[model samples]
Target: MAEYEAKFTELSGFVPEFVNTEEKKARRFQLATKSFISRNFSNKLNLNVVPLREVLQVEIANREIIPVNQVHHRCKLKLEGKAFEVDLIPFVLGKFNMVIEMDWLSSNGVQIDCKKKKVRIRVQDGKEIMFKGQRKTHKFLTMFQTKNLLKKGNESYLAYVMDTKKEIPDIQDIPVVNEFEDVFPKDLPGFPPDREI
Candidate 1:
């Protein structure tokens, strides 16, 4: 195998700088439940699937964020028992209102259509329930089928998987999955450009 030299360069781009501060504008975080997992291991409830046979009208603690200042807050759902952490990531979905999204580690995550003020989610074993457009997508970003939301329902229900959607949000890089290291690669060797071609 021929050895190859690696070199990297950036053509140019714009990055948001707050108050002329030289800080990376974004970070990633996560919320998982050891409690939710126990139910799957214990003597009865199968954690592999969330029982959605009769459960509907899911109560969620909505979250929202301000992009300019990069601030976040919960919807003040002072529910007694089981406090859930909602992820408020910055996204360019038309306006800045695409702030609060997805409840962490739930059977199905939540995505709110800011303009519609309606929530999008998925069920464990349930099918997709329509809400509006003639073309609707799947539950979450996983193995499931997609459909259209031609009708309106008070609370839309779905199965967990973003089976289809031509414009699904790119979310793979926003969540943390391993150890956190503060340092970045700054000492990588560069390759010389070939000038004798």
Candidate 2:
């Protein structure tokens, strides 16, 4: 355990805390309760849990997604009311989504807002880092393109399509006609006034 702590501290820059079995059991029970509540009442009650990955599968559809093991492990750092500087790295992960990393500081703290899909970190030196995870659909041809890159291709090919099809409208906004001229009189309440008269 001492060697593990030394290595963890060396790699993470934070000394790990050793929790007793009773404390571990209590934390696990709390997490389980929160998970149950979030799963059953998230949409209806707007309840959120911490570390979003716990309740949702956060990853790209086709690309490799980095695991949250590091973030989860580092989040255990706690220096209450201490000002700190965070080393945050924002990168594009699967699809158009973003993942933030902060593992270069000691005695850092992290807060995860599952409802907002955001992570907030407090490091040494009175600094705070906050970021949101991105989840946007893209065209199949443009899936790999990011804000820094541009690509030209078939825009119809979708990288991610809606899970459900759009419902067909019962009434059409425009009247179906053979020609534009035919559409005018039938489609409009009255012939469009010329010059607003």
Candidate 3:
């Protein structure tokens, strides 16, 4: 997916709210597709989305026509502090959570700045808001890459772990603790079984 995204020299990264829930989870929207939500995701979220009576035939890159039947009407999406209502069709898009098509963006007068990685959207009041894309610190290993590496059996892999907790300095290292070395000693004598500190 990263490889395909990199092929296009356009600004990427758009996340909008899909449903009204306590957690307020946001779904990723692909700029390429015709506004769609994954069928599995819809079911998992218990969106209770219903299928349209008329199935739409969607042509893919391979010239295959896929019938889309499910539609979630009037889905509220919040972007840059503004709310927009849109209808989303459910489809089986493997890694993609959802997609916001170019039609919606163009119709809404949204501007994309690839160089700056920003999206500009004009509200009803004619006020323009800029949303910046978060910079990627490192390229994440894709599922395909992981599968291939594991198949090789002798491949070297690196895992990156992030720690969010702030580290606290040792109590004995504090300036005030230096004045009370006897109370807070660097090395304390072992306490007896019944002794309490």
Off by over 4 Å in 1: 1-5, 9-73, 76-94, 102-130, 133-197
What lDDT, from 0 to 1, does candidate 1 have? 0.32
Better candidate by lDDT, 1 or 3: 3
Candidate with top TM-score is: 3
- Report the C-alpha lDDT of model 2 over 1-197, residue by residue, as the tens digit: 99998876676544334322565456444433221211222234332223443332223334333333112212222335544332211223324222223233222467888899987776556577787988877654343554235444433433676657776433344356333554445356865568854
Best by lDDT: 3
| Per-residue C-alpha lDDT of model 3 across residues 60-117, encoded as one tens digit per residue | 5454558777789888778777899777888877788887788888888999999999
Candidate 3's displacement at residue 188, Å, is 45
TM agreement with the true structure for every prediction: 0.20, 0.22, 0.50
Error of 3 at 49 (Å): 2.3
Kindly provide the TM-score of model 3 when superposed on the true structure, using C-alpha atoms: 0.50
Taken over the whole model, the C-alpha lDDT of each candidate is: 0.32, 0.41, 0.72
lDDT measured at residue 69 in model 2 versus the true structure, 0 to 100: 16
Enumerate clash totals for all models, in the order shown.
6, 12, 0
In model 2, which runs have C-alpha deviations exceeding 4 angstroms? 1-107, 139-197
Rank order (by TM-score, best first): 3, 2, 1
Model 3 accuracy (lDDT, Cα): 0.72
- Residues 82-183, model 1: lDDT tens digits: 243432322233322333322342444545566775555544445332244345675563322222332333345565976675564333433562223333
Model 2 RMSD in angstroms: 19.9
